[model samples]
Target: MTDFDATAYLPDDLLERIRSRAAAVDAENRFPTEDLAELTAAGYLSILVPTALGGAGLGLAEAAVLQQRLAGAAPATALAINMHLVWTGVAKVMSDRGIDDLRFVQTGAVAGEVFAFGISEAGNDLVLFGSDTQAVPAADGSYSFTGTKIFTSLGPVWTQLGLHGLDTTDPADPKMVYAFVQRTDAVETRDDWDTVGMRGTQSRTTVLNGAVAPADRVVRRVAPGPNPDPIVFGIFSVFEVLLASVYTGVARRALDLAVAAAKTRTSKKTGRPYSDDPDIRWRVAEMALAYDGLLPQVAAIAHDVDVLVDHGGQWFPRLSGLKHRAVVAAKQIVDDAMLVAGGSSYFQRNELSRLYRDVLAGMFHPSDPESAHATVAAAWLGPVGG
Candidate 1:
């Protein structure tokens, strides 16, 4: 990945266009449809798929770098694409390990099919290990999933919805079903994505009323609760790293804006530019120092994933900890950045105002602060009560 050019796919001109539309998209609270079309045309969605399959033939490390670049320009657009990349990334992870369960996802990316992540439920804290949705098995080995999924990004334009549900008909050995449901009448996307920031994502709630996945699309059926499934690993690794990349990018943008503001805004009390003031300098430096470690950490973990490093049981801890640190560091950077930018940043037109709202969404993604601490603590000091 050292030789990789992240901006090659994104390009400066393309990102400038995407960046230009971000504020309007946010103001209108609509999905970045034009941005998606432009990226789709650029083959940005297929970067992680193998080149033989008509993709850019990149790995997760390169993807992490590219996402950071894209997110810095337009966070909502990058986040909207993250859902699709998660599926393609999982496909790559499986194919890399000789598991072809999700190879179709890679090919689908090349074919311009959009994949939406639908694993999140309203109250399911067990995440990948358990499901509240019902997956009824049919005689043909297909499943009809009936449940509600919340926070489904790319709600308006996804071609496929990848989700999981529980099949409880078997009293003794029920399984968690992982499958992809095509867009159909059974899948209803509610138009309820109004938010303070990242409005362009339009991550709405989806209700599945007997949404069916054919036998071929039913990729996995694993025993629920802490099973060592490869899909689980793939999802956790790719999702956490990419999620961190977007937030880290936002932090980088905030830091840049802070530096720009400090160099221009003169302090009346000191009769000099804020950048020359010791306190402002300290705050900006603190923001930079905190932000600096995030990219390297993201790149290191993503590289380890790409290279298939053997982290063993510690993988969960490492992935969750990395995400936690990145998000917390990002929030801190944005807060300090707003202060450094002075009062002008409080206006809606200011980029910092939008970024401040967008960065808050990072705290709600999977491996949340509480869960991350619990995960790391359990790894170092055994779970409570042995």
Candidate 2:
């Protein structure tokens, strides 16, 4: 890749501190206080805030590396940071086109403002299929939002939101606007984040009653653009693939822990370490096979994106297939890790338990397994009606 000095953007020591703090934070179901601070101190939270604005100018590749490495340390912390990375990318893209609310991002970056993706709504089994939040225009040249957003990642901690909504009054309209809203202290948050997994993510419901969004605070919500250059697609592909990267890292650690457990425990009947058992070896081998298979696929997808870009053609199907493979591979890897670890994987106190939950999150993300498959099929086969 490019000779980008990522270390200059954020050092290793701080990442360790975040990791160390993450375990405890995950246990307590608390926000990763130290991790966020360390990230801010390293200017990692502002990696895409633009160099002109006194922030790191790292692009999507660097951002993917940061998330993947950090997720290896703490998946919850990494997932929380993923929201910010998304916001940063959104900001950077908007800024490049001069359609962004730089002041909001700039002010938020310095203010340590957390931006939540307020896309999920109550009663929606699927999170990405738009939202029920209504944004109505006012006579005073502003929009008033009235709705509750459910399971908002980093909900209680956010000072800003990348809110997605559509105006239903005009049902025939094909366009929906995404706006950036600044959260005021006056808004209320519910402490109902009781979940089976990713507890520390603090994903909860938020209520906005007549929350006024000013004109300047609104950034046009644009769909993620397909890469024109295959090479650039390779670089950008990292963003989607990194979810798999983080999950793979989590599964790898689970296997590591299992192997350690096997090495110490002796089989009562055999009077030997479990490591000597052929059955245990088989399980471990399976786990290793699963983990080993993921990295190269990601690398190849990245290369394909790069090639497509260099060749000057759309890499949509290639990129979609990459996403599909990444998600499927991640699920298989995590499931294999649990199988290798056995029933102990069910215990919340174990790291494997957390990894299990974090991996499940991937199945529901933007390019989820089914969605990725559909996108790839559509790209290759065209519409079925024709």
Candidate 3:
């Protein structure tokens, strides 16, 4: 029997650390160093490693729950941890291939060190196939990779690197050889990543030049077989869902502040408490309703993922829909919170302002609004048979 219990996987202590310093965490836009340490020490970073390797061996459902909880405390930290979760998931899946990738897994599981994904490129529109990076084969079947991958979150912090590139030597093979190279003397991280939102992510640019990638480090790209796990979409879903939850928590904080302000402030023109004003009461009510509305949808989608994964059906459409819905709802929820909070919400020091900016990143998730809608439509309406 597996030793995975979904309920016990959350990092409560790390959450406490996040809750305690949330204000300061936003105030400085600093990486959540303390929170990362807590996760590492508590084995939260290794949650997806198979139980045989001394990990929690939980599924994507439990992983989403943990991500959501972490984001509820700190969105920036949650974003960075998403990279760790993706690495752990990849390790677990690779382990099932009947080979020993445990060395890599153990390195990350014990030291709290791994890599951010290297896929996106600068000025590249077609992100899926736009891999400017290249990996050429050597005589001994080893590969030398060279290229710069931009917007790599935790690029500077991780001990390894996950990269994708086309093996042009086999043009007709239709497989872009994927590889993970050790972060030794070959890889370099550029001073980039000053973004509008998610500033705390430290998403720098990584340049790989003649990086030696052993045969064991290479994996197939988007393998299409009888059973494709759709792990990428699953990872994207976790990111979108948790980010929505975190922004919702921030909106909740804003609403709480608005309620307090309404009760205490007496409008000079009306000569009464703001809360007594119909307009003020209406705003508060609207904000509350929006927040309440989003929670159930997010929860229901997460539950569906759990149920589907348990019963064994590919949940591509469902996961895509959940990501789209939750992120869109979070945008609406935060907008309402800002509306109710009024001019005070604009202050940089105000948590709501930071959260408003942070939540916007949800729209750019891999399974974004447009793609997600298309996935659902294709599934429900079927193809045109063209």
Candidate 4:
């Protein structure tokens, strides 16, 4: 963890520029187009693609480090990019485990194509395992997906949408189809990304009215409900780890802001800076402690994924718990930062206020509080029915 240099890829100057635009991007409720353009130019889109495929060939752990740095400056922008990384990251995961099925995804990223994750569906709790969308298979092995996908990040410019749908063509056994569809007439992007925070993401709704994935683009056809499919594990593992990275970065930024406030903001009562205030010092220490605790866990798990550490069945719960803790810790750190920074942070224009709003969106993301708890409980205490 100490050896990896996150700023090596996303340098401080570029991040500073992105951070400068975050407020306006959020306030205007638009995608971070400039950030995307800059990141794409920086080869960020192919972070996970193998060097053999003309990418950086970085591992998941390194990617986590980079994401945390990016998120610290501009969380929404990092998150908007997270979707694209998930696909390429999934490809890396599969590749690491000796599967080259999603190799084209890697090359596509290298060819300057943005991939968006479109597996999420409204009211669909069985994420990555099942879907409400329907997949109709053709004689040519192509499949047309007809359903709506919610929270489609990178909505404005994703060239390929990696999505899933339930295929019931085999009446006796239903299989979940995972495929990629290019942006075309069949795909509709609803401009409805107005949100409380993270508006810069513009993770709008995608309505796929029989959008097609050619035989080559059709990746997985695992049966519904907890299958031992590589794609499922790849998506879940990479998704959870990267999500944790982004939120942990948010917490790190808030902690830094609180420390800065403590050193600079003077306290009239004590005739000294807030840093001299014992109460303020204690609060700052607690926030630091909380943020510090999660770093090792996030790094270890991400590295485990990279090296293919066989955690066996405990993988799902471990990943879920990492994301849960990172988010919870980030939200707490931001709240404390606001308190430490005082009234100035309450204003909408302040970065802490923006972070406060941005962190709230974390709770709504997958591996939500309830589901995370359930996953951990079932993993540790055995399934309820057993």
lDDT of model 4, residue 221: 90
In model 3, where is the ten-residue run with the lowest total lDDT?
223-232
Candidate 3 off by > 4 Å: 1-13, 20-29, 93-103, 123-130, 221-314, 380-385
lDDT per residue, candidate 4, 59-159, as tens digits? 99999989999999999999999999999999999998898889999999999999999988999999888899999999999999999999999999899
Worst 10 residues of 1 by lDDT: 1-10
Residues 1-386, model 2: lDDT tens digits: 46756566556776677667766786788877777777777777777676777777666556655565677778887777777666666566445545445446755775677777676676653333355777776666566677888767776668787675555655555223456677775356788877656666787788877677777665443222332322123223444655555665566666677787778777789999988989889878877777677666655654443232342333545555655565566556666666656677778776777777777776665565666776667766876775
lDDT of each: 0.94, 0.64, 0.66, 0.93
Q: Alpha carbon lDDT of residue 31, candidate 2? A: 78
| Candidate with the larger lDDT of 1 and 2 | 1
Model 1: per-residue lDDT, tens digit, 150-186?
9999999999999999999997999999999999999
Q: For model 4, give the 10-residue run with minimal summed lDDT.
A: 1-10
Q: Least accurate stretch of 10 residues (summed lDDT) in model 2?
A: 226-235
List per-candidate RMSD values in Å. 0.7, 4.5, 4.3, 0.8
Whichever of 1 and 3 has more lDDT, that candidate is: 1
